[model samples]
Target chain A: MLKYQQIASDIERYIEENALQQGDKLPVLEALMARFEVSKSTITKSLDLLEKKGVVYQVRGSGIFVRRHKRKGYISLLSNQGFKKDLEGFQITSKIIEFDVRKPTQEAADNLNISQEEDVYYVKRVRYINGQTLCLEESYYSKSIITFLNKEIVSESIFDYIREGLGLNVGFSDIYLQAGRLNEEEAGYLGLEKGFPKFYVETLFHLTNGQPFDFSKVTYNFEQSQFFIQANGPL
Target chain B: MLKYQQIASDIERYIEENALQQGDKLPVLEALMARFEVSKSTITKSLDLLEKKGVVYQVRGSGIFVRRHKRKGYISLLSNQGFKKDLEGFQITSKIIEFDVRKPTQEAADNLNISQEEDVYYVKRVRYINGQTLCLEESYYSKSIITFLNKEIVSESIFDYIREGLGLNVGFSDIYLQAGRLNEEEAGYLGLEKGFPKFYVETLFHLTNGQPFDFSKVTYNFEQSQFFIQANGPL
Candidate 1:
């Protein structure tokens, strides 16, 4: 390892051993340089590396302090998989707000390829991780295709029920994400102030037969989480 | 097409014909209902669909209004491609801030898999689309692999020079995104107030030989743009 990397690793170890929390300041730059037997430039480079990793941040005139590592929420845009398997090591729960057969709105009807006269199962849910509400999801499912759905299924992973219980094949999805200020009701459910920035994700899920089955709009608290996606290259 | 969809399409056409600018109020709900000979619910649903599609936004208690369609900038997370092709319709330009070889910081050295003693080509550019500064990019390249770079190359597309001029194969990238407040310098460059929300993206680009070549951090104006990704599913 390079000198600065070695120093950065040592500092990370120190942070761990001392159980430093967010906002806790590290040693002064001169003191760190002396302790590590490095020049001021070397110490600055190490600190810069730490800052880049989001482990520590600088306060300009004050000093370098630890940053709160916000727990990230990941959604694999590449796969039509259930969140149950992806969020391992986290306590995940869902609260079903509404589950009833409702007349499909024009948008939902068009996306689901159903007639406006048809009734779709509308399920609204709030997802939580470790007791903190993180996302509000409003989904419209075609009752004609997804024939087995209830409040119990809605509370759990609906994707699992569709694939395992109903023995159907789950296919791909087309998703669009936008950032916007949360409306009043969304802010209330997520415990955010009105007009707080939120990420709105619109997903259209299809089955193996190439029929759209579900259309969902998920709003996430932008401050608490992020979305991850990977792309392979031909360009 | 559904009845509401037809009405929505007609409304979109009307907006185009009138060349309504952003913040321009649409016709009153009652007027639209009477003109289309549709019920209030139908007109309301059509407007709701438009809002969801991001064509227009509603102001509660006032009326539905035309939303300025913000031109979206696309960065493919799955590919190590340049933005030149993606932003073809817009007038894109770059202002080179700094272009010279510099000793790699520890983070850059590790990401580019280079020795800290070796100098690397460092380039900083403020990218503008249609005369509006949208992103600030700071990129570091391995001198051994790239072997040739200058301000002229930085002003155009560096990826194009790497692939076309150097005859190198561009490969995949590992990207991480976080939300942060703009620092003083960044705010000055983007003309944003300090502490304004910004999207920070860190990218580590690797060649087809699995050797790291480029490390870049792009800070985007949060309120003016959004990042998009599409995923195909097998999982």
Candidate 2:
């Protein structure tokens, strides 16, 4: 890692371990330079990268503070081609079962916060981690974003394209979870018997501007996967 | 509604409208008594109810305070009838397609945080809501808890009986959501053509004392149902 990257991680660790709540200023540039034994320019570059990555923010005369919220949400681009970074132990296998551009259904329209007849892109893929079938994801994107997609892009993480290439940053999502039975086609694809129980989730992601960016439905096979959500209640 | 209930609603409305955050103390009893035009006894009674309901809490020598967290989690009763409370809104037509008490498999043992071969109650139910198939729920419960359960209790909202009568609460849960295709048995239960997509969620609830309580797999028919989760990420 670069010297500046090490500084960034050091600062991140300190923030995680201490009382550096949102809006708290960090040590001055001279302080960081002395502490890390790095050049003043190196410290400046590190803080700049952190700001660009949304890890921190700069206040012209006030100095820097940690971003109020860290990487709290994600816009996942589930695909067969290993995305930008793969989960260490998980191997992802994706099969594009369907891809089409069609007028949004009422449900899709409501999710995207658009008119019902507007065009949307529907893409479906099945993912396997390790050797076990894990999940199936069906993504719905507004037609305005369809221009950014192509068949070749489908093979990689669509999220990478949307972010690095298209400059669309996905923020938090409203998610729901429930249980239901699988239909026949899904059963065959997931290698399970018909009438088996499955897990389901629906998600709506919004951009930083609070506009709907993507909607998706996902299902997971029984016995092979688990979920973890941190509960931060009313407070 | 009772006069006290109205007073409670008024307080709740005031809190919301004024954007009062947790830890903010309520106005003094005399002030509330005058403002709401209710008897001192009535206002005190309303506050008492809110405290018991886990909506608010009081500290000795200190005034009342809003609860920082809503203690609204699950309670799994041993009885089948206790399942109705949380499982409401679904015109539930349930068939216990598979039910057993057996040694925990490796995966089950790991999820339940129990030793291999530990006894567990495995139950699978296919639920139909509104005359349409809705979801399938598969659950695993530790034998210690299920020993208190019976066929009659399994048919209802198990959460209610455990909470109301036994005082056992399923406190915090670490939930995860993903997407996947239905396997054959699940597909048949929901009456879907093969490869049809659905939503999937896997949940693990932990007891207040930090013991693993239950692991559940839920699947929902995409055309009919959606799961909802509200998140305010680590603030």
Q: How close is candidate 2 to the true structure, as a TM-score?
A: 0.46
Q: lDDT per prediction?
A: 0.75, 0.64
Calculate DockQ per candidate and list them: 0.14, 0.14
For B123-174, candidate 1 gives per-residue lDDT tens digits of 9999887888878999999999989998888898788899899998665455
State residue B200's C-alpha deviation in candidate 2, in Å. Answer: 3.1
Candidate 1: tens digits of C-alpha lDDT, residues A1-235: 6899899989988997998875588999999999999999999989966764545766667788775332355644455555654576778888988899988999999778789998789999899877887789999999898886888888877888988899876654556665666799999999987777676778877664456689899888777666554433342
DockQ score for model 1:
0.14
Supply the global lDDT for candidate 1. Answer: 0.75
Top lDDT prediction, candidate number: 1
Which digits, one per residue and each the tens of the lDDT, describe model 2 over residues B1-235? 6999878877877876887755578888899999999899999988865653434555545577664322122222111232344356545567777787877777667777788767888878887766787778888888776456665666666566566656775544445555566778778888886556666656666544435567788776766664344332111
Model 2 lDDT per residue over A1-235, tens place: 6788888878877877885755577888889889889998999988966654445666556677664322222222221123223254456667788888877778878777789777888888888776677778888898775455766677677876877778864544556565567789778878888767677667676553345667888777865654444331111
Candidate 1 ranges beyond 4 A from true positions = A1-75, B1-76
